[model samples]
Target: MTAPAASPALRRPDGSALRVLVVDDEQMLTDLLSMALRMEGWEVRTADSGFDALTVTRDFDPDALVLDIMMPDLDGMAVLQRLR
Candidate 1:
């Protein structure tokens, strides 16, 4: 017999608030990521550029950040460096 199907994409059992920041130069990818994260009942924010990511980090103060390695103006490494 086949095993049970996979559960939902996101699982928030503790009912804790999750703040996420997604940074990518590709608008489509960013939108998709944001949509998926939000579906998990998480607070999601997206930044399409390095500068924007910095700005968002300041204001959004996300608990976690998903950033592309290569981005225009500011790459992920550079951003991480600046944050440090």
Candidate 2:
């Protein structure tokens, strides 16, 4: 059998790599998601807390977000609300 074809890389409207921010209190989960997204050619960043998520969100200006619901400091709902 022939090797599998590579998938197309994700890109933004201006042609830059798609930026994704992953937030989770669990470090393992964040790392796993980051690895998977990076393999797909996305620019991935991870935050371990809601507070840090907000800080990174401001600087990264990510095109997409993967957020966990329950967190120690601020929780996902608050973070999303603040973001809006």
Task: Judging by TM-score against the true structure, name the best candidate.
Answer: 2
Per-residue accuracy of model 1 over 32-75 as CA lDDT, tens digit each: 98998887788999998888999999998888899899997999
lDDT of 2 by residue, 1-84 (tens): 999998777699999999999999999999999999998889999999999999999999999999999999999999999999
What do the candidate models score in CA lDDT, each in turn? 0.86, 0.95
Worst 10 residues of 1 by lDDT: 8-17
Most lDDT-accurate candidate: 2
Clashing pairs in 2: none
Model 1, TM vs. native? 0.79
Please state every model's RMSD to the true fold in angstroms.
3.2, 2.2
Q: After superposition, how far is residue 78 of candidate 1 from its true place, in Å?
A: 0.4
- Model 2: lDDT of residue 43: 96
- Counting only residues 3 or more apart in sequence or on different chains, how many pairs clash (N, Cα, C under 3 Å) in candidate 2? 0
